[model samples]
Target: MIAAPVTPAIATLNTGSSSLKFRIFARDSLDLLMSGKVTGIGTDCRMNAKVTGTGAQIAQELPGADQEAALAAVIACIDAHDDDWRIDAFAHRIVHGGATFTAPVIVTPEVMAELQTLCPLAPLHQPYNLAGIAASGRLAPDAQDIACFDTAFHAGHSEVVHSFALPQAMRDAGVRRYGFHGISYEWIARMLAEQRPDLAAGRVVAAHLGNGASLCALRGGRSLDTTMGMSALDGLPMGSRSGALDAGAVTYMMRRFGLDADALDHMLYEDSGLKGLSGLTNDVATLVASDDPRAAFALDCFTYRVAQYVGAMAVAMGGIDAVVFTGGIGENAPGLRGAVLDRIGFLGPVESLVIPANEERMMAIHARELLETRLELMP
Candidate 1:
């Protein structure tokens, strides 16, 4: 008896601050083979995976696992299932590409170095993203690593949309708006083009409301403008991120409290936003269920800001044809969505849609396309 040959697959990794969501897709058909996530990293971590089209599943706890450990467990789960699928490419969700790298590219040493320089732009996300890439190289050196940037979809913004009112030197040094969540927005754009061609060609506002939220103005499925600026900490207030804070307040805090860079980073990135506003959990469902006035206020603020930004996005595109809601909170929270849409009712019966985000699939699509292009160019 001879062993069967392993099937090649594309592994898509969306590494977040405390979670790593992944999916394995068949290289030829792009069908999902396995999907899972490692949640609660650095604490009581858990890994759950299900082999698509079958009953094969994995559910286990990884004690005190970090990103690398979590990814190792994911690979172990893949190997344990004997699924006969080998990951030929690792498609990573890179949070920031800065002013360059506007498209997916095969990661090389030079590319990795350039990406490292961008870690400061997305401190909470970029480092972990690159860490996953490094771990994948060690764990599976034969696999090709491809970087799919979250800022790439918005890279075509005009100079007016990308600039900040700053000195020429600072502006030239990359101190300008470079929107995040392009992966989710790109998926939404593609979905709109496929499902609602009428709206796809017109002005659209997409709200990606989750732990990290932002609004993108899409004209003809291309990003015309967005709410996020320079960092994920801008735009709409998120689970634990302060959005659209006044620069004066930051300076005031620094002077009054003697807060250093690290202190400010932690407060703004991890302690502000919904968590700070509510003085309760950052989870929207929990906040919605709470009777606390602070929770109510937090929810109110979130919806109000979302509504305000929708208007801004509409203004950016000159008008609005449709409003798209995506991301975790955007797709699930109806009351919140209603609150936002209700506030924007003055826009006169704007079309409203709730599209489920599938960024993993988008990354897989990019990987497959890049692979095909590489194969075609081979002699």
Candidate 2:
């Protein structure tokens, strides 16, 4: 049998610390062509993706460990679907940009180097972020790569919003708030601008709840403030993170529990939050479904913390126009949405909306802009 020619489309990749997600979109309107994710990288990589709307899995699945191998699998999957598809560019969700990158920038060696230095700020994520970027360069050298920073969207915050009550030296060392989970919030911000322009122009609080969660106060579609400070673990209680933890307590734990840096990292990154409080699963669905008192207590803690951030962000934004939720737990978990909103009812006239998280799509949009602009500049 003769093979059919592959249709042309733009391929966008959103590689996380341990996961790689990709989507194919037609250049016109950038319609969703296909999407999938390779998970559990670096140790027993697992592939899971459902077709848009239908939720169908890919045929030749990539099973193994290692992020680079997983990435190769994603490339192969896309190539198989449309061998001739012209991958115009690649978009990456880079986690940190220090004080430099405030918007999407074309990837370069210097930019990558500056980002790598931020590994100390985001120890668990930055190394992997760099790894993913390097892999993309190697795997798809033909496509233009664009870096969309998770910290860039929050760079709009006022000095008062980002400042910490620390010494001048520490503040000068970039030890202030640099909000994370920005891609999710960025999408929500755009949704508000398009669907509810009035709210977008007014003060609003956006909670991006998921395995990793953060709240942002946005005024005029820009970040007025956010809960996360310098790292992803500083905001709301996440799937397995101890949010807003006392630095003193950490110091005490080191002396008392004989916990080293590595031990604490494992605890904060994988053993705390819902999993720690509930003594059960970190998955919100599991906790929500279970009748265990510990699970209920954990949910209560998560809800209360989210409500606290809303009030704080409301104060930061002056007042609140709307409360937006966008993330795995945000978009799908209506119960969580209600719990957070119910607690923040004291905030005047707040409307709630759920626009499913689309960081991958957002990346595609940025890549398209970068590509079109580059083409225009070519003599």
Candidate 3:
């Protein structure tokens, strides 16, 4: 008897600073086969995975595993399971595509070079994202590698929204605002279109509140404006990242505090935001459960900023019809969501929703579309 051919699947990788979250989807059906992550890469890395719709699970400690090793371990886990699914394509969640790539594209050497130049724009994310791509290429050389950009969803923003009040030369040199958390917003838009067509057709403000938070204004399921600008460091205060800050304050810190560029970067990106404000922990659950006044103050600041941004997003679309929340805190923190909604109650009876962010699924969808398009164009 001849052996049956393995089923083709798309693997989506969302790589962070020290973590890689991944999911495998059936190529044709787009059904999730398995999902997993390798957290704390370069430290005491732990890899965990679960086969969808089953009791099969994987958990292991990978000592000193880097991004490439983590990916190799993920592949090993998938292979260990007799799922008989081969990863035919890798769909990467690239955080920044700069100003050129407006849509998902197959990764090429030229594209890789261009993306490398954008690392400065998203220092904390872009480099790791590119590392995932490079790792996938090395480990699965025959598989198609597709880059699904987080910035691609917001690439259609108008000049007024994307531009800063900088000099014409600086604006022309790609120093303009490039919104982040767009992949999550795009998933929210698609979900709304299918589940709540009424709101999807009208003005909607989506608050992706999490470790890294941002708000996006959507009109007819398209991004009109967002809070993040130029980098993920902008927008709402994150777990450890400073949100929007005064340029003057940064200059003052550099001069008064004797902070160099690296020191400033570390302080703003890793030592600020809720973590800095709370003086306890960045985890919302911890902050919410604590009796400490600092935690309460941090939570208050977070919700207040979220509400403020909602109003800004509402203004961007001329009116507000609905407010959708997603991401870790957005979907799970009912109190925080209610606080945000309550604060924005002055906008009149706007619909409120909590939609789970499915960025990995969105990447898989993009991978399938690109794959099918390639087949269609083939002679």
Candidate 4:
């Protein structure tokens, strides 16, 4: 059985670049009381709110051209719905925690500042993440805010797994392999540790594939290594983000394409990967289902890149015991999963499993502990 959280008014706030998602958990059995998202931050912002247990949904168009306006709209909707619920704690899905914050943290000025500086490392994600927090302080002042990092899971990677060929000065500047999508991996790690301790104790690889994708290698339920380096764009080819490109190739692209630094960054961060390669949809499902050769090629690129990293991760751990899948494509696209698994058959006989992505619930459970009693302190 999946473990649930115990909290009266606890909700996880997942702030993306263009949207905000939240799920409220009740203390008794930690069932979802409500879930909602305000999408399209800049204009024509839309919201879909649902009653957690009943699945009753109400849709509304929220006003906003940015994160601040988006938060106000979310707050207005929550307020309009008169309920017995009183929000006690807010857990945020922070995109980056830099070098520290391997574990969840009570939001502090120092932690917030560090996350802000790391924005350049993930220019597309960190500012919006911090913006949502600042907005929370304005919109939900009574709630005790907590931050859970997406990079925390890979904090245990070996020095070699994290190093770049650059000089020590760059490494000293925190330019190392700080992996991404850690909330999902961290949740899966704990799930495995609780329900499948044998595999949890052994070397395992968890692939989180979606619009944003990455893979994590774990041993003894800790992150041994991951595909994403200093940024989310450094891993396997994602929906629109290029993965694992040579530094020299970047310079060459700049020269040949007459690409400015910002344009190059935009291409790598937003326009490359599956979209650039396929010249079509960035979604894995779309590519896998399409009849176009380019779509097939895109699928091949994605799976091939992922499979190649699987071998590298296995090498990092000496061997892999199980290969698990999560995220949109990871859990839903069995064909894609099969393609990746088929390519890495040599790494087997590793077992494979699919677990739905549940980072929000994970954050709720984490906050539930901090609100009730620290689980680590318990017997």
Ranking by TM-score: 3, 1, 2, 4
Local distance difference test values of all predictions, in order: 0.93, 0.82, 0.93, 0.84
Q: lDDT per residue, candidate 1, 225-329, as tens digits? A: 999999989989999999999999999999999999999999998899999999897899999999999999999999999999999998998999889999889
lDDT of 1 at 270: 86
By the TM-score metric, which is better: model 1 or model 2?
Answer: 1
lDDT preference between candidates 1 and 3, better one? 1
The parts of candidate 1 lying over 4 Å away from their true place are: 1-5
- TM-score, model 4 to reference: 0.93
Q: Where does candidate 4 stray beyond 4 Å?
A: 1-7, 373-379
Per-residue alpha-carbon lDDT of model 2 for 44-138, expressed as tens digits? 57776555544557844455656678777777766665545677667777888778889888888988888888889888877877777788789
* TM-score on alpha carbons, each prediction: 0.97, 0.93, 0.98, 0.93
Give the residue spans of candidate 2 off by over 4 A: 1-8, 49-56, 59-63
lDDT of 3 by residue, 1-379 (tens): 9888788899999887799999999999999999999999999999999999676888999999999999999988988874789888999999999899999999999999999999988888899999999999999899999999989999999999999999999998899998988889989999999999989999999988889999999999999999999988898999998899999999999999999999999999999999999988889999999999999999999999999999999999999999998999998999999999899999999998999999999999999999999999999
lDDT (C-alpha) at residue 276 in model 4:
90
Best by TM-score: 3
For 1-379, candidate 4 gives per-residue lDDT tens digits of 9545433678788887888898777754677888888888787788889885556777987665578887776667666662666778789988888887888887767778877887888787888888988888778888878898888878877788889988999999988888988889888998998889999999999989888999888888888888888888897998888998989999999999999989998899889999999999797777877899999988888899999999988987889988989999898899989998899897658899987889988888888777666446668
Cα shift from native, residue 11, model 2 (Å): 2.7
After TM-score superposition, what is the CA distance of residue 314 in candidate 1 from its true location, in Å? Answer: 0.8
